[model samples]
Target: MNAIPPAVQPPVNDEIDLAALFHSLWEQKLLIALVTLLVGLLAAAYAFLATPEYQVQSMLRPAAIKDLDALNRTGVYELTPEQAMQRVGASLESYDSRLAYFRANPGLFEALRQPNRSLEQTFESFNREAFKMLQPDPKKIDSLSAYVGIQLTYPADVNGVTLVNGLVEHAIQAEREKIAADLQTVIQNRLNQLELKMAAARANYEASKDARIAELLEADSLKRAQLQDELKALRQQLKDRRDNRITQLDEAIRIAKALGIGKPTTPSALGEGERVAQGSVIRTEVNNQQIPLYFMGSEALEAERNALLQRRSDDFTEPRIAEIAKELQLLAHNRQVEVLNQRENEDLFLKDLAIWREEATRLRNLSVDVTELKLVSVDQVAVDPLRPVKPKKALILALGVVLGGMLGLFIALLRNGLRRGASRHHSDQSSLSS
Candidate 1:
């Protein structure tokens, strides 16, 4: 096999060729110097001629106007710092809001726009500048704390400090008004509902009282009628018993006299010996002692004893009926107590409703009071600053020097590459001719 020709390779150095690089740069020093000088001059001119911007900074804390109670019930509390920042950031970011802001203060962006500009041109020019000046710092926003920071840059003619304060005021007022209006509507509706409920409760209580009174009256009338009938029967039976007893005593005395067993003149003598033996009204013991006890006629005595036994038997059902009636009345009494308790519960509910109404009214009033509230308090106010915040001359010039040096180095390397290619071409041609 024929030996393969060696591959042509560019020279490689493990160590950097410092001397050759310096020589090459020296040879093309004029071009490098000219290019570096041009870039530096341009940077210097920009640093001096550009309009300086001044920044107005202010720190704000959004005060909590309402307490925890408001948060739980109506959620009509004051704006927080996070919310304030969001509103401000949104307003600045939005095209329409920014446009409106620019319109309100016509002179704010007048310097940026040329004369006789179209509406679109004016808006575009305004937005270009507004975005640069009004943008919140990414570093600051990322590490947000309890306080919101506002920084706006403007030209010397515009008052950036006044613009920041005004923006904050407007945002706070708008948010407060929105929340307050919503809370008021909710409060009114709740109050109306509470009033209706209270009215119903009162009417129910009255109806319940009237019905209970009617029920008690009817029960009392029924009980009174039953007791009156019982009393009348007892009185009539007692009178008949008294009259029959008297008639029985007279008949016994007449019978004794007619039978001649007890003579009117000799009753005492007959009663002692013969009265008991004959079963008369007066009786005598075995010792001839007369007793005052009297006996009815046999038929009457038997009939009356039978009637008494019947009366005792009748008393059994009357007592049991009365007992049952008493129990029924007790049940009615218990029901009346339950009704009273129910009315009491309704009264409690009404009282609670009244309290709820009062609370709603209080919240509504608070909401009204805070309708146009200034929730943000300026902890640090901005003033018209005398010094310019931008166009840092020292930093710009330093960066220009570094960039210019780097460009000069690139140009030197390019010149060195061209010189190396010419030398290599000459050597190749000489070798071919030999």
Candidate 2:
């Protein structure tokens, strides 16, 4: 019973004074009201005046430079993801190559690398301003990122939309022009090489024209004169031999007619006429001698004597063999020279034409490849942007209001504790004086 009375009489030291808290809040009512009102006004103003900019985001799947012919050949309709990635990498090479000031011009690479004072100054100025704005904004331009499309937060206003659209169009045009210009450069280089070759040929022609012409004409004239002389000699020998053969033939024919044994009749037709008008007299003589020898040796003696006149004369009587042999030798020499000249002319003409055709083909193939790249483009349309299904305003505001009220209540309690301690100190002094 004593412990219970003492427990009832003992004062609690740690108990929070709710009345003091209420009094402090009542005293600081204006300040609390002001703070609450200010917070509410700020929140409302932010909710109303702050323009919510919608970031229009749509995905872009990279469209590879596909060959319709590949489908026709393989019958496969689509590329695997790996194959698509490979194509994306290849296309990225253009971007990387042009990444140095957008493929400004020839010698641009060297110029960019070189540390010129003016260029360094320009770069410094650009980087200082660019560091804040540039911030790797892929969506600001039609940048390729793993074949994905992303647009950064931008105002849905007309100027913002126009800026994005213009950048995209500019990037596309730049890519196309870069491809075309590269083609033109390659073509121009080949053309220049061809022009150089042509110039060299023309120069060579000019330098050696007189000498070449003189050499060709002189060689041809000398060959023609020599061949003509040999042909004339051959003709003379041919004529002399022909005349001797004709004389021998005539003698044989006359003797054959006298002897009545020009040719024996064939077994198929016993009554057919003898064939003797155009045959070599020597052949006819040999046949007649052989035939006569079988019958009687003395009968072929006249035929042998008649055929001897057709023999190529080695003596001074006609000199027909000697003349024909010399003529044949001269004709052979002239033909060799003529063949050489003809072969040389044909080889020279063919070689130059082949070189010209090869050069033309190289230039044509390069131009074709360039043309193919220019035709690839963005084949997509923009639809309305999708709404973000996050951060509902009413819920966030309610949460913020609750959190603010709790914080205000804690601060009020802290003030109340300090005031209660001051009150206790005043009471202790009053008790000591009594």
Candidate 3:
């Protein structure tokens, strides 16, 4: 056999074919080097140019009026604390309802960026693009948000900082309006409920008032009748007393008649007994004018006679009827006053009912407003502005060094690839020398 070439042995499992790998790599090495350098330089440039972002944080507490004391007890109110808390929470939840109102107004954001945006609109194009450029995604805004969150967020750009700040401010405004409206609505609802209760109460009072008035009217009639009856009895008693006084006067008149004071005293000149008659007549006249009238052995008869004559008066017009008339006048006046007072009270009750009705109406309006205000609730506060965080200059510098070394290695790899044929010849020489 011709001097056979020594058997060419395949490499073992533990060994790698470096020559084959190096050959394959050598083919693409130039393009790979260029791409690697480009990537490294691009990374460095990104570090230098990346904009930085600053954050503004805020926390808010939900506020609302609550019946805290009563709500704390379950057995007393037949409701759980959770339920009562929920009610209070509902009142506060309305703050989120007015978010849209703030979103439309950009001026609010401008103010927020005040120190930053002195005079620049900060963009080459429309405000929308500028805002986007200055701000980050909204979803990432909040760092710590649950009950309260960031209401607005903004990005920093040499040109568009104002726009981003404006957006954030609008967001906050929207939230605030929403909160106020919500509370107002809840209050309104409560007011309406109170009004309804008050209205019902007023209606009942009015009904009761009517019944009371009727009762009073009947009582007034009874009182008037009683007064009239009393007057009648007094008048009768007065008449009887007057009748007794008149009867005594009649008796005195009879006594005076018997005495014959007004008859002529001269005797007739016809007979012997005529002088005796004249004498008798003179005696009668004496008795009537100045006789000592004794009455039934009573020692005070003379005093009584004097008193009877002295007590008579010409002004004694029917005393019974006069007294009755005076009493009736007083009763009629009292009845009139009671009637006036009752009417005034009824009027006042009606006025109170009207006021309650008005209050109820206002309450209703407020409840509706509360619904609209719910959008601004604390949970809805903006957590993030639309801006990117600032780049770390130190980190970028470190990365630049690393990438530069990798780039130099890639350049060396390409050079090795291009000289692969020369190296292979040199390898043969090494074999001969060996």
Clash counts for all predictions: 0, 0, 42
- Model 3 lDDT per residue over 1-434, tens place: 68957655443353446886567666756666676667667777887777565444433333332323322221112323333233333432333322232345445444334554442332212232322211134578664422333222334533233333344344445444544555455566667677677767768877876687677667767877876787667656656665675566456445545643232222222113334343434332223344333222122433454554565532245565566567667655556446645675453655466666666665444322322322223323334445454565667666765776577556666666566657766866776565
Q: Please give the RMSD of candidate 3 to the true structure.
A: 16.4
Clash pairs (backbone) in predicted model 1: none
Residue-wise C-alpha lDDT for candidate 2, range 1-434, written one tens digit per residue: 45532222325387656775577888867656555555555565555555544443322344444532332222213344334433433433333432433234323223224355565454344334321111225556665443433243433332333333333444445555654565567567767877777667756654565466566657767766676676566667766776675565556555555655534422223234455557554332223333322122223434554555555642344455466456546544445445444554442533274686577676655423323432223333334446422233565466555655555566666766787788888876776555
lDDT (tens digit, per residue) of candidate 1 on 1-434: 99967656555444647898798788878878887787788788888878888877766655554532343345544445456556654554556665666677676556656678876687776456643423345667574445565567777666677776666565556556655666667666766777777787778767877787777768766876776576557556655665575566556555644544332333456545644354455634354555322333334444554565455324343464466556556644556646565664556634466676576667556534555444556667778887787787777887787788779889789878887778778877776555
For model 3, the stretches where C-alpha displacement exceeds 4 angstroms are 1-39, 49-198, 209-342, 347-388, 400-434
- List where candidate 1 sits over 4 angstroms from the true fold: 1-17, 45-54, 62-145, 153-159, 178-190, 217-374, 385-393
Q: Which is the leading candidate under lDDT?
A: 1
lDDT of 1 at 119: 62
What residue pairs clash in candidate 2, if any at all?
none
lDDT of 1: 0.62
- After TM-score superposition, the amount by which residue 89's alpha carbon in candidate 1 deviates from its true location, in angstroms, is 9.0
**Model 1 Cα displacement at 317 (Å)?**
22
lDDT of the structure predicted as candidate 2 = 0.47
